[model samples]
Each structure stands twice: as C-alpha cells, then as structure tokens.
Target: MKCPLCGCEKAHKHGKTSKGGQRYLCPHCKKTFTDTFDTIYYRRHLNTDEVHSILQSHTEGSSLRGISRITQRAYGTVVSLVRAASQKAQIVHNAKVQKIKTKEVIGNEMWSFVEKNKKPVSQKN
Candidate 1:
C-alpha cells in the first residue's frame, strides 16, 4: 500500500516484531510507517485490537485514565488518540450536516444537554 502521508508508492518491509507485526519504511519520506498510519493509533506502537479498544472506549465516553486501565496503555497515548479521533469525527459530522437538505435534520445531544441544564424545571405542588 502507498504511504498516505507522503503519497510514496515505494515502501520496504523493515522487519517483523515479536508480535508478528510488520513495519514499513517509506522511501520517499524516509519515515517509518505501519498499518496504523493515518489512523487513531499511528505512532502509538499498539496492535490493531488494542487500537480498536481505545477508540471504542473513547467513543463510549471513557476517560483517558479509564482507557489506560482497560487497554494497559499510557494515559497520554490514549488522550492523544482520542483527541485526534474526536477532531476527525467532528469534521466529518459537520460536513455531513452541511450536505443535508432543509427537510432532513440530525439531532445531537450538545444542544439538548445545554438547554436542559440551563434552567431548573419548577414542579407545582
């Protein structure tokens, strides 16, 4: 596969790790790449399953520390991946929303949550 970052079509298999993971070196950029490149776990040195777990935890509202305990990864790494993924998701969501016609509306919790918390509801005895 081509290197997405530098669009290099030439890549060499550096070596396989103990986990049977293959590493690639991009000839054009001279940068080490892997299957996780341009993904949430890029540069994190994590396996595909662990990367999926991290993303799942983040999407489910788990904190970085929480994900660290579950995935056995550093909290900083979890935070970094979550932040990048969140930004990417937001961009995709905005683009999708923009493409929707006036007849089609998508509901998100941010607006409802703010409205609900903004004022206290009064109960009549």
Candidate 2:
C-alpha cells in the first residue's frame, strides 16, 4: 500500500496496530500508517458501512439517542460521529462553496407558513 502522507508506493507491511490493523511502512517518507489512515474510519471502531448508516440516519432527522439505539452503539459514539461528519462536511463546504450577492433572500418562517397553509380550489367548481 502507498503512504497516505507521501503517496509513495512500494511500501511494505511493517506490523500490526494495537487493534490488530495491518500497518504499512513507507521507505520514501519513513511514515507508518494503516489502511484507514487520514479517513473518518481511522482509529474508529465503526466500519465504513456503519459510519454511512449513522450519517444517513442523521440526515433523516434521527436523534442522537435514536441513532444509538438503531445502530446499537453508545449515545456518545453517535454524537461524536455526527460531530466529526459535520466538521468534515463544513470543511468541504467552505472549500467548494462560493458567496454571491443576491437581491432578495427567502427566510425560513415565510417558507414554512406558505408550505403549511396552501389554499384549495372550490370542490363544487
């Protein structure tokens, strides 16, 4: 595997981590890392699919406790994962989002009122 820090190939297996993850050593950069290095899964017990499920639940408006119960993980773990995902999303948004001046902006209160109070046509007509 290649080193995450240097992106150098030809790295070889060095040892196993305390958690039994295979570790690779890079000769080019003298850095040691695992398959999950620099990723959200790094040092986390939850796998990628588990992390994805948590994120999906969060997007679906599930509460932290609810997510914990659904995923069979601790409440604190749910919060930590949500926070990490939020931070990562924020970084990506800050990097890729652009600001533009607009003449008018719609507020949430107006949108909610409009959404909940739609008028209906006369049934007889």
Pick the TM-score winner: 2
Residue ranges of candidate 1 with Cα displaced over 4 Å: 17-20, 61-75, 91-98, 109-125
Weakest 10 consecutive residues of candidate 2 by summed lDDT: 108-117
Per-residue CA lDDT of candidate 2, range 23-87, in tens?
A: 99999999899888866778889988999998888777776778889899997788787777667
* Number of clashes recorded per candidate: 0, 0
Give each model's whole-structure lDDT.
Answer: 0.71, 0.79
